[model samples]
Target: MQLVVARIGRAHGIKGEVTVEVRTDEPELRLAPGAVLATDPAAAGPLTVASGRVHSGRLLLRFDGVQDRTAAEALRNILLIADVDPDELPEGEDEYYDHQLVDLDVVTVDGVEVGRITEISHLPYQDLFVVERPDGTEVLVPFVERIVTEIDLDEQRAVIDPPPGLIDDRAEIASSRASREEA
Candidate 1:
């Protein structure tokens, strides 16, 4: 299987180096030197990593045969893909691959069927799971330990404990909370 590992950003310097927005958690291993990655456009690569370095909290990489700023700029916004084995898992116990989470059934702690995970969105601070409800509507569920309690791969489901108004409409949640408080 092929997984998107990074996206080529603007050229960093005049030495063929380009900044990359890393998608994979294991950048040191996946984006290492001599690693050959396929490009999204299907014509920009397969670009081999000639060298890589962390500069001012950003990852910069230079590809083989891509020298100078002009050459690096030409590859801007291109996505880098890596060939991965389907059975390969992440090193960390709690870490999960985006492919593994996608398509899993989403349910509340009370066993209420909510939706199915359609996609995983990785942000700088947190990750979110895009869930498609049975009614065909979509909801963004924050992939946090507090909200998402468990991921049962064997059962093909994700158990979530969402806060009031998280899954339901805010007005409904507000009225329900008020009624409970009154009682």
Candidate 2:
């Protein structure tokens, strides 16, 4: 599977250089000259990293075929992807990627299958799972250590002990909060 590692921000210089906002934690280690990256399907075709270097904590990349400012400017907002095997990822006991969690079956401790994970929210402190139930209700379950006790990526299932008042009510709460703020 290919995962996004960076997004082209803007043309950095007049010589076909573009500033890249790297999404990976190890940006310096991941992106380098000769690296092959696939642009997001919505943006354009895959491109090989012609040359790249860290500049001011961001990556300045030059694609193989892109030359001049006009060409580089056309790549802005394009996501860079790399082919990665999920099984090859070195994960700790409880750690998981947002991609791995998406579309996984979410079940309660009592063996009640609740829904499937449709999205993962990156909060300031922790991640949250957005589970879409069969009835179209969305559950916002915090992906905390205690709440999410088990994750089986191979089985595509997750065991969660949702905190009190955290499930099956996100839509109402969000709407109520929005209405209150507006008033």
Candidate 3:
């Protein structure tokens, strides 16, 4: 399996080290030196990591043969991919690959259908389920343990316990409007 590990960001300094927006949970294993990764833009890499460091809370990597800021600047915005065993899974029971959750039905605890999981949004803080509703609108459901109660792989559904005003806005909107009228 080919999984995305990181995306190359701006050139950090004049020393060929480029800032990286790491995608993997296991960056220590995936982004270490001597790890050769493929790139989205074929010209940017097949990059071999010479060294890595953490500067100002971001990952910085110096690739082999990319010896100057000019060379590093050319690699901006390319995604890095790693070769992995297809059968391998993350160690944690609650963890999952993005591919595994796509296209599943999203429902409330009471079995009320909310939407269909179209994509997984991997933000810095958390992952979100980008769900498409029956009417073609979309909603972002945070993929948190407290809200997402179940993930049934066989049944192909995700059961959620959404907080107030998450799945629906009519109630909150109506309440605000009534308050305005009272004032």
Give me the displacement of residue 147 in model 1, in angstroms: 1.4
Writing each residue's lDDT as its tens digit, candidate 1 over 1-183 gives: 998989999999799999999877678888999999999999999999999999988899999999999999999999999998889999889999888898999999999999999888766688899999888888899999999999999999999999976789555779989999999
Q: Candidate 2 lDDT, tens digit per residue, 1-183?
A: 877778898998899999987655345545777777777765586788888876776669898889899999999898988776777653476566666778999998887888999877654356678899988878788887799878988788999888767664577789989999999
Error of 1 at 44 (Å): 0.8
lDDT of 2 at 66: 90
Which pairs of residues clash in candidate 1, taking residues 3 or more apart in a chain or in different chains? none
TM-score of each: 0.82, 0.61, 0.81
Q: Following a full C-alpha superposition, what root-mean-square deviation does model 3 have from the true structure? A: 3.0
How big is the positional error of residue 2 in model 2, measured in Å on the Cα after superposition?
2.5
Q: Rank the candidates by lDDT, best first.
A: 1, 3, 2
Give the 10-residue window scoring lowest on summed lDDT in candidate 1: 164-173
Choose the strongest candidate by lDDT. 1
Stretches of candidate 1 exceeding 4 Å from the true structure? 134-137, 170-183
**Candidate 3: segments with Cα more than 4 A from true spot:** 122-124, 169-183
Q: How close is candidate 2 to the true structure, as a TM-score?
A: 0.61
